[model samples]
Target: MAKLVERRPLKAWERLNILAFLKGMRTTLRWLLKRPITLEYPEARPYIPDNYRGTPTLVKDIYGREKCVACQLCEHICPAKAIRITPGPAPEGFSHIGRAPAIFQIDRSRCIHCGLCEEVCPEEAIVLQKEYSFSGTDRNAMMIDKEELYEAGGTLPDKYFKWGKSE
Candidate 1:
């Protein structure tokens, strides 16, 4: 006696497709006559949703100071280690000044924009902003410096958590 091999049955939806094909055709025809939803490049631009992560924004602290204490928290948090900071001296009247970074840089060539730096920053010195319309001519120009990042980024909130004001 020969034994028959059993096979799994086809899905119910796939078993019957004549009506489905007609419905799909009708939908396609309706779409064909409708207005085009795509925007033409070099002439038109699409809308980006709010809170979209586009660029890394640098923020300052209260008293018109830099929020970063140069603790190297963000640098350590960055998986790519794209962040570089060099410490500097602090102004007078503060004997307990912590490490102050004179050189802060973020290499766009390697940055993943994971927002880890922002989340790990004890001072919230950085944030992912909505500035997505950035373009560069060369690799050298893409490496953002401290002053440039601060200038390009939006102003930090008037009072951050460190300043004792609630969000």
Candidate 2:
């Protein structure tokens, strides 16, 4: 059996909700007096830390040559399967590396920015840059090819040329 509960009637002031309105106004006034923490985007990009994992890009050696030997380690390790590589014989003077990627592509839409590709690369050819803001009109626009990756990565100084004779 359910027990019957007695209900108390609201007072005149409570029915009018005057206290509730004043409480809401107090909250609004408190917030209005505080300085805003919002940042104006586009005009003011937030600071990106040194260890920020953003875009994945293929870097070049100090000599402006592609550092990737086309081992396909990045492709194999990518959890999202965003990387694709096709190996070919190394270009003319780059015979020291034996092979290079004839075709390399990264689909930004599929990439999770996990930095696994960067970590798995034996040559450190793949790097996760501090470029978090990127947009594309369509899927094809988001697909970054080998040349675009090289351009975005620019050049990272190599302490030693593993493929060349040590000075």
Candidate 3:
């Protein structure tokens, strides 16, 4: 057998929702007095995860030779038209197989960070790096050239794991 339960009727003041509004205001005020979680930039750098794709960089072969064949695949595949490469034959005494780029430039302003250029690179020359803190006074300064790319890419300890590859 079940016991009979008595139900209490809501008062007019309770039905007005004043109590609910006061509870919400109390929660908001409590949060307002808390410290901010934001860090001071320039003095502090944010943590970057391993899979972060910040900047597109060029990589070198194990022998310190430029891995790019100057094939222009990355340039053609870039949807933003940010990549530009001037192809030229390798020097007479060079052991490299493919033509080298006379002028390779990446306009950071136009790059969309889609990683399409890195995906299409047959030689695996281009890779998305973990560097995001970048600033320039002028547009031309943001346009990264071959030398800068080489410097940034060469120092990387590991090559970017190709996307869609089985571990």
Candidate 4:
């Protein structure tokens, strides 16, 4: 069985709805007197924290040599399957390292920017940089190749070098 509910008649003031309108206007007027907190973009970028993860890029050592040894750890650990690497024999001068990436590419559209690639890299070559405003008109333009990654990452000072001369 359904329960019956009593219906009540509206008062004259409630039917006019003037109180609701006045309440809404009061809220609008209160906010209109305050200053806006809008940020002027392009000229002013928001503050990014030290631990902020933006995009993955390849870095070189302080000596201007590539730090990645083509370990493929970053590619294997990537959840988005955005990273691709083709391993090749290390250059003649880089005898200490066994292999290097003949070709390395990352599809920006597929990347989730989870920082897993950075965390899995043994040589710390791949890192999440503070560059978040990457845009491209086409799919090909969005793919980050090895050269481009290195150019964006620049070089990072390292305390240990596998190919460093003995003291």
Ranking by TM-score: 2, 4, 3, 1
TM-score against native, each model: 0.66, 0.80, 0.70, 0.74
Off by over 4 Å in 1: 1-35, 40-45, 91-97, 158-167
* List of clashing residue pairs for candidate 2: none
Q: Model 1: how far is 88 from its true place, Å? A: 1.0
Residue 100 of model 4: what lDDT? 90
lDDT tens string, model 4, 2-73? 999898889999999999999999998998999866678868888899678988889887767778999999
Candidate models: Cα lDDT each: 0.76, 0.89, 0.81, 0.86
Ranking by lDDT: 2, 4, 3, 1
Model 1, residue 127: distance off in Å is 0.6
C-alpha RMSD (angstroms) for model 1: 7.1
Candidate 1 residue-wise lDDT at 162: 54
Q: Which pairs clash inside model 1?
A: none
Candidate 4: where is the Cα deviation over 4 Å?
A: 1-36, 159-167
Model 2 over residues 1-167: C-alpha lDDT tens digits? Answer: 99999999999999999999999999999999999767899798888998899999988887788889999999999999999999998989985688999999999999999999988888888999999888999999999999999999988765434445331
Model 3 segments more than 4 A misplaced? 1-36, 91-94, 157-167
Worst 10 residues of 2 by lDDT: 158-167
Per-candidate Cα RMSD to the true structure, in Å, reads 7.1, 3.1, 9.0, 4.0
Looking at model 4, residue 21 earns an lDDT score of 99
TM accuracy, model 2: 0.80
Q: Write the per-residue lDDT of candidate 1 for residues 59-144, one digit (tens) a residue.
A: 76545566667888888889988899887776454344465678989888778878898888777778887666666788787789
The backbone clash count of each candidate, in order, is: 0, 0, 0, 0
